[model samples]
Target: MELFFKYLQYEKRFSPHTITSYQTDLCQFQEYLKEVYDLEDISQADHAIIRSWVVTLVQKDLDSRTIHRKIASLRSFFRFLVQQGKLERNPTLRIKAPKLAKKLPAFIEEDAFTQLLDQSEFSADYKGFRERLILELLYGTGMRLAELTNLKLADIHLASSTLKVLGKGNKERILPLNTSLATSLSQYLVKRQEAFPNNNSPFLFVTDKEAPLYPKYVYRVVKKYMSSVSTAVKNSPHVLRHSFATHLLNRGADLGAIKDLLGHASLAATQVYTHNSIEKLKAVFEKAHPKA
Candidate 1:
């Protein structure tokens, strides 16, 4: 298992978050096998055992997407073992994941976001500036939460109005900064320097204590601010990202251009936003069209 983890880390170049998720899924599966079947060796599990585990997950009412990811983790692990000659056949080869329903990504409306950014009052100091910049960067660039947390001061190119983000698989993408976002970033940098003149953290955003930003901290910050303007069930950082792409698509930006900005690996991922656009169009037609 350690060898497989190392392979995922070094050879596959999976991000720490992804590697951690794989580890968690495997551990949970192992624990389940141990408790249910008294099976000590995961490599000894057959297709029946794997399917049973999937059934147990379904019975537990776990989300289908989560169950799918767990099965994927098992499939990858078993395949690796087979390639290494430790197993003659893969246990998960016949295993099937639950089908996922087509669900549109939830996003904050443009008006709500605009009101959140413009009308909501942040403190008139370092904390306020940092909070504002966090919202701006997430919506402005559509970067993932991990990418935002990993952002470095050197990644910001003020002169060119660009941000270099290290995304999944360590792929780097440059996102253009709009003038308003750029000015906000410039102002935030000065405030950051003023707040921490002696501290020299390399991250673009940091905690109030001059330390690097963490996922939970960012989530809390986003939730706190987003709640004031949005009634959406989810007001996480990813909603800001969804808002970014949806707003762009609503404004008639090209799909390929959106894919590039969002750092998506393929067009399929970016195409989801089009569903939101279609919904908007349907609303317009229903309201404005003469033939009802």
Candidate 2:
């Protein structure tokens, strides 16, 4: 497992969050194997043992997506074992993953988001300034929460209306900002400086203590304002991001261009936005079409 960790950290260059997930999943599988079947060695794990563990996960009522992730961790570990000549074959290869439903990504309406930023009042202080910028950057740039957290003071190029985002897998992409987002960013910087005169934190967003905002703090901040502005079934920072892409597509933004802006790796990943657009079109057609 240490060797696997080294490979993931040094060779694969996976992020800490991802490495932790892999570690937890692998450890759970090993504990299950030892307790259930008295199988101490994971190297002897085969198709039947792997399948049984999956069945137990289903019986435990875990989310299908979560089960899929656990299986993926096992598969990766097995592949690594094979590469090191410790195993003849990977057993997870023969197992079938449970079928998953294609759930549409939830998004806030343009009017709702517009009202949130324009009409709603934030406190006339540093926290308010920081919170507003958090919402603006997520919705404006269509960046993920982790990307926003990892953002640095130098990443914002306001003069050019752009941001250099380091996204998943440490891949860097350029995202353009609108006049409104650029304006909000500019405002936040001045207040941030006044709020923390001696603070040398390199993070773009920070707590009152001048420390970088953690995932949960950011979640609470976005969730609170999101609840105020929209009644979407889900209210998270990513909802704002989805709203960004969906609204862009509805306004005739090209799919490929939206893909690039959202930092999607492939067109297939980008096509999901089209489904949201189609649903909107259907609702409009039902109301306005002559032939009902």
Note the clash tally of each candidate: 0, 0
lDDT for 28 in candidate 1 is: 94
User: lDDT per model, in order?
Assistant: 0.93, 0.90
Over 154-223, each residue of candidate 2 has an lDDT whose tens digit, in order, gives 9989889888998767789999888888989999999999999899988998898888889898889888
Residue pairs with backbone atoms closer than 3 Å in model 1 (clashes): none
Residue 90, model 1: Cα distance from true site in angstroms: 1.2
> What is the alpha-carbon RMSD of candidate 2 to the true structure?
1.4
Write the residue-wise lDDT of candidate 1 on 1-292 in tens digits. Answer: 9999999999999999999999999999899889999999899788888899899999999999999999999999999999999999887887878999788999988888788887889997999998899999999899999999999999999999999999988899999999999999999999998989997889998888888989998899899999999888988999999999999999999999999999899999999999999999999999999995
What are the runs in model 2 whose C-alpha is more than 4 Å off?
A: none
TM-scores for every predicted model: 0.98, 0.96
Clash list (residue pairs), candidate 2: none
After TM-score superposition, the amount by which residue 164's alpha carbon in candidate 2 deviates from its true location, in angstroms, is 0.7
